[model samples]
Every structure is written in C-alpha cells, then in structure tokens.
Target: MQQFAGNSCSRQEMDELMQYVREAENDQLLHSALQQQWSSLQPEEPLYPVNWEGMYDTIVASPATENKVGLSPSPIPLIRRRWWAVAAILLVAAGGIWVWTKTPQQKTPPVIAAAKDIQPGSSGAVLTLADGSKVVLDSAANGNIATQANASITKRDGVISYGGKAPGVAANAPVGQPLMNTLTTPRGRQYKLVLPDGTTAWLNAASSIEYPVSFTGKERNVSVTGEVYFEVAAKSNAPFVVTTPQQQVTVLGTSFNMNAYTNESIARTTLLQGSVLVKIRNSQLKQSSYILEPGQQATGNAGGMLQVRDVHAEQFIAWTKGYFLFDHASVPDVMRQLERWYDIEVSYAGAVPQREFGGKLERNLPLSAVLKMLETSKVHCKVEGRHLTVLP
Candidate 1:
C-alpha cells in the first residue's frame, strides 16, 4: 500500500488495483475486506502522504478494455449509492488516494485531517471610545452598549449605531477638537456601524474605521485601515470624507467600497452609486484627483498617480453580503482573503501555483470545507492548527 501511495507500483499492478476498486461492489469478499480495513483504521494520521495527481493520472492512463475509467467519462455504471462509498474506501485502503468525481450529494471530508477543525469568522468587533475605554461588542447584550458625547450608542441586530442626537445640534454647531472613536474588527470577525450622521459602514475582517461620534463643522471626516463599505448620507453642506493610508475619498452622498489594507499593493475605492472624488494623500506637488461615477473604481499606490477604470462594483462589496465572489482571482488573492476571514496563516511550501479561480463561496463554511472546494481546482494544502501551507 505504501509503495502504491508513493507511485512505485508497476503499470500492471496499478491497473489491477483500479479494476478491483471499480468492481468491488459485486465481489462480496473484496467489499468485506475493504470495510474491515476501513473500520480497523486508527485515529492516527497516514504514514505517507498520497500523490493525488500522480495516482489520478495513472488511473486514467490505464488501458481498461471493458469500461472507460476517467472521471469525466463516467462510463462505468453506478450500481448503488453505497457502491461509490465502498469504492472510495477501497481506493484509499489500497493506494491512500481518493478522488471526488461527480458525487455532489456526498459530504466531502477535509483533505488533510487535523486534530481540531477551524470554524468560520462571525459578526463582531471592538469599539474604542473617545476616553480610551474598550467595549467588546460581541459579548455585550444587544442594546444601549454605551453612551458617548451625549449620543446614545446601541447595538441591535448585529449593527452598532449612534442613536439620539444631541439636542439643538446643527450641522454647523460649534465643537471642540472633536471626540473621535474607532471601531475595529479582528482577523476572525466583522462588524457594521451606523455613524452619527446616519451614514452606514460595514467593516470587513481585520479592518477599522475611526470617526467622530458626531459630525461637526463643514465636513464629516474619518480614517480607515483595511477594507470597508460605506453608504454616506447626503448633506450638501457637510461632505463625507474617508481617509485611508494612500488616498482620500470625498462625496456628498455615495455608496462605495474601499480596500486599503497595508499588505495590499494598491489602494482601491470602488463606487457603486452617486459620485466621489478620489485624491492621493499628500500629493500636493503632483496634484492628482479623479472623479468616479457609478460602476467605476479608483486605484492608486503611495506617491503614484490615481487611475480610474470601469468595474462590476457589486463584486467588491460581496464580502458585506456574506460570500466571496472571485472573478478570475489569483491564488494569492484568494488566500489573502481566506487568511483574514479564517484568521489562519498561509505559507507556500514550493513554487506558488500560477492559477486563477472564479466562483462564489459562502463565508460561513468551515476552513476544511473551503479547502476541499479549492482542491477541486487542484489547489492542495496542508493544515496544521491555524496555519495552512499551500503545496505544489
């Protein structure tokens, strides 16, 4: 079995083993043997890692005179549902290799079994008050979490809001240096906020937004790190301004998604509705600014010119909707997202796969299930604790 797993078996030996797997159901002796072997297996990990691609190629290349053997052809007739399970077990017991073909109904176990399974991230965040007090919102009951600057702070339906306006407060109300608060989400958490001016913001995992508890003077200004989606309330006199590490987006009333994580090479501001002006931070000498209409995006880097292009704006905000929508995204791009949401560290064992993925996956699935989905595209990985190492 170890020799077979290591691809040391002769062609004839491999062919006979595949044939045995294909016909294991009709042969009761083979079925019982496979079942006994599977049931007697211990919880210990496998001694040798299976070469999945090699084993699959060998099986498909075998000259089967009676039935076509590849997964795509599906020439062999499936006699019973239990037969598929038995055949998969037989393949694993014989060669330590198992391939999922067209059984969509069957639940796929993790590709690499671990002692503990990592769950998905949930809705949560930490709120830093103006006085430097921290409130863990997830564990707090869902109402009147705190009060700040004469504004009632409430958490309800997974959204934190600054309710109750300071009586007689006007857009041009005189204010001091302005009390600021920050809402931050950890790697394994997300959060939503309703700013004092009624603007809504959704913070993705490992992101944050710092804003005053109340809008004052001529404009409402905020700074953010990481990714955030916003629906700015319309106030002609008080334009909403969002400042990131690389750029600043100013709009009277607009919906947009901003991705400005420090690790990312480019800072992006994608506009969904209304108009926004994107300007490079401290680019006074160069003087760069771009006006983005709906369905347009502005991308720039530090000390670089801002570039605007058309895009499907909805795709950028899909994370706020509880799923990842990857449109021809590279492996590193996909893994970066997974790293934040699952709070897992990803490293490469060899050359990174120059592969692109396009699909929509739920954000609520376990890390293992998500990895299994990636395996369908031949992306393999080994998970140990909270670390996932991509394998070539």
Candidate 2:
C-alpha cells in the first residue's frame, strides 16, 4: 500500500512533539525517533543556526520539561532510560554489532503493484428477489429493481429499501411458502437493508439476511447468517425475531447486534436498546431463554446454555462505523476479520504467536498499513500475490 508520512513538520507541531518527548521521561523518546528522523521540520519550525539538522541537536536545544531525566554519555539519548535501554546502549556501544541485526524490514513498503491488489471493501451485496432473480447491487444503478403486490424493492446510496402498499397476508402463513428474499454479502463486502416493516439492518462481510418481502402477520421475523446489526422498528402488536443456525433472538423494536458466524463456535447477541430474549437452539437440556438488557450480550453454542455478560456495545458496532476494534483479540481472530474484508488468504510460517491486542484501526486502510501496525505488536506480516504470511 502507499506509505504516507508527510515530509514537513510545523514549528508548533514540532514543539508539541518535543514537549511529548521531554515529558515521556524519555521513554517515548527513541520510540518516536523514527518519526523525527523521517520527517523534516517545516520552514516555520525556527530551524536556524543548527538548522534542526539532527534529531539530537533538536532534543539538545529543546527546553527541559517536568519529566526530564538526568542522562550520561549516549548517541541516542533514549537508551539512558530503562535497564533494557542500558542493555541496548551497551550492546550498541560494545561494537555496534547488535544494532544492524534488528533491521526495519517490517515497515518497508509492500510490492506496490501487488500491494495495490488489496484495497478496502466497499458497500455491496447480492439482493435475491422472491423469484430467485439476483441483483448485483454495487453494479446495479441505484433505483427501483423489483415490485411485489405489497412492496417495492429499491436500491439507493448503498441501501436497499422496501416501500409500497401495505401487507396483504402474513409472511408466516403456515399453509404455504412465504414470498421472501435474501440479501447476501460475500467475503469482501457489506450492505444495509431497510425491511418492509421499517427495520434497518447493517450486514457485515460474508453475511446474509433472509426475510419476507413484506410483513403480514403478528410478528416480523428474519433469519441471519454470519453477522448483522439490527434496528428493529417497534410495533406493539408485532415483535421482531431474528433466528440463526445456533440461536434465536426476540426483540421488541430494539437495536442490537447478532454475530453468528459459522466459523465461530459461539453465537453472540448484543443488545443496545430494549430487552431481548435469547434462546439457545442447540441445547440438549430443557428449553431455556435469557433476557438481556441494554449493554448486555448472550453467547453460547448450540449445545450449551446461553451465557449473559456485559460488554461495550460501541466496540461491537464499530464495524458499522468503518473500524476494526479489538479488545484482547487474538492474532488469528484479527486475521480472520482482515481476511474477510481485504479479500486475502492468511498463512502462518511457524507456530501461531500467542498475543492479545487492544486498540482500534480504520477499516479503510490498505493491507500493508494494517500489517505494519500489527508488526508493532511483534506480529510480522508479509503480503505477496493475494496471500499474507504471518511470520513467527
């Protein structure tokens, strides 16, 4: 991907950075050296007699801050901080032998042409009409696509909307098949849908949601595979129900997120508003259900009791806002998400590294940038062709 670090740094920005370096007790001093070394001060940074020539000179000229530490002889000022820094300095000063061994292969640019192959996923999905006709939404010009007796299906602005005449018959007619359509997203895509009942759904990558073209009965029901976030429209007479292969979630016009990826062992339903009844379908014991309040989640497999827990709903919904939020998430778990959105395969050269990460990254960044950030956590990555290899 394109590695971009501006060549210019403003005076105020540089001063603020100098303050950060001075106040980090020199802990973040060398940590930030790479950036300081790579970036040049803008004409406005007051780089005069010494010309802001070297990062050391800049540090030497910087005013001592509250977190300043006393230091001795050192080429890189930061090596004077912790015991590890002392060892680093001793190794470097011993003959500078170890310095060359830890080369920066991780931050180097990827094969640009090959790197260009990995771009962010966009809004898209395959909308199947009641008759089994499919519409490639991204390629289909935004407008009306299909019309049924009770509703008209329209695609506009990456969203599919159902609007038309009122319901004629219940979608859950037990006598015959209901007229339903499926919205599906492949590995590298996601989509949004507005149900005939005015319920909104945000489908994540490699996910699908099947529902009637129009709600006819006493309840609005839909079945989801993979992951989907729902904003159910409240109808006092009709409760909304979402079913998955492993579990079923009943909600009363509340907003919630349901993650039922087939690859995962547990299906999780997180509620943001309104209460939800989570029922386990795989349980061999007595039929049981768990009522979840706002900011709560229910997770379990088909054969186990659904466990209720508290969670930060924002983290679960960040994907809908274009982010990859990981809270103590494993490397493989992160790779799985990356694989889905970047549309690439991931392989391991050695034993999988046991690491947990906590942070947030924009989903729109190129594969290389994400890998570069991952490398900081000691997870080395190399992208070639359409595959990414994680090295131990």
Q: Pick the candidate with the highest lDDT.
A: 1
> Per-prediction RMSD in angstroms?
10.9, 11.5
Candidate 2 — what's its lDDT? 0.68
lDDT of 2 by residue, 76-97 (tens): 4444334334322222222111
CA lDDT, every prediction?
Answer: 0.74, 0.68
Error of 1 at 372 (Å): 0.8
Identify the runs in model 2 with alpha carbons over 4 angstroms from their true place. 1-117, 166-176
Task: Give candidate 2's error at residue 204 in angstroms.
Answer: 0.5
Clashing pairs in 2: 170-216, 282-302
User: How does each model score on TM-score?
Assistant: 0.70, 0.71
Residue-by-residue lDDT tens digits, candidate 1, 195-280: 99999999999999998887866999999999999999999999999999899999999899999998787999999999999998
Residue 379 accuracy (lDDT) in model 1:
65
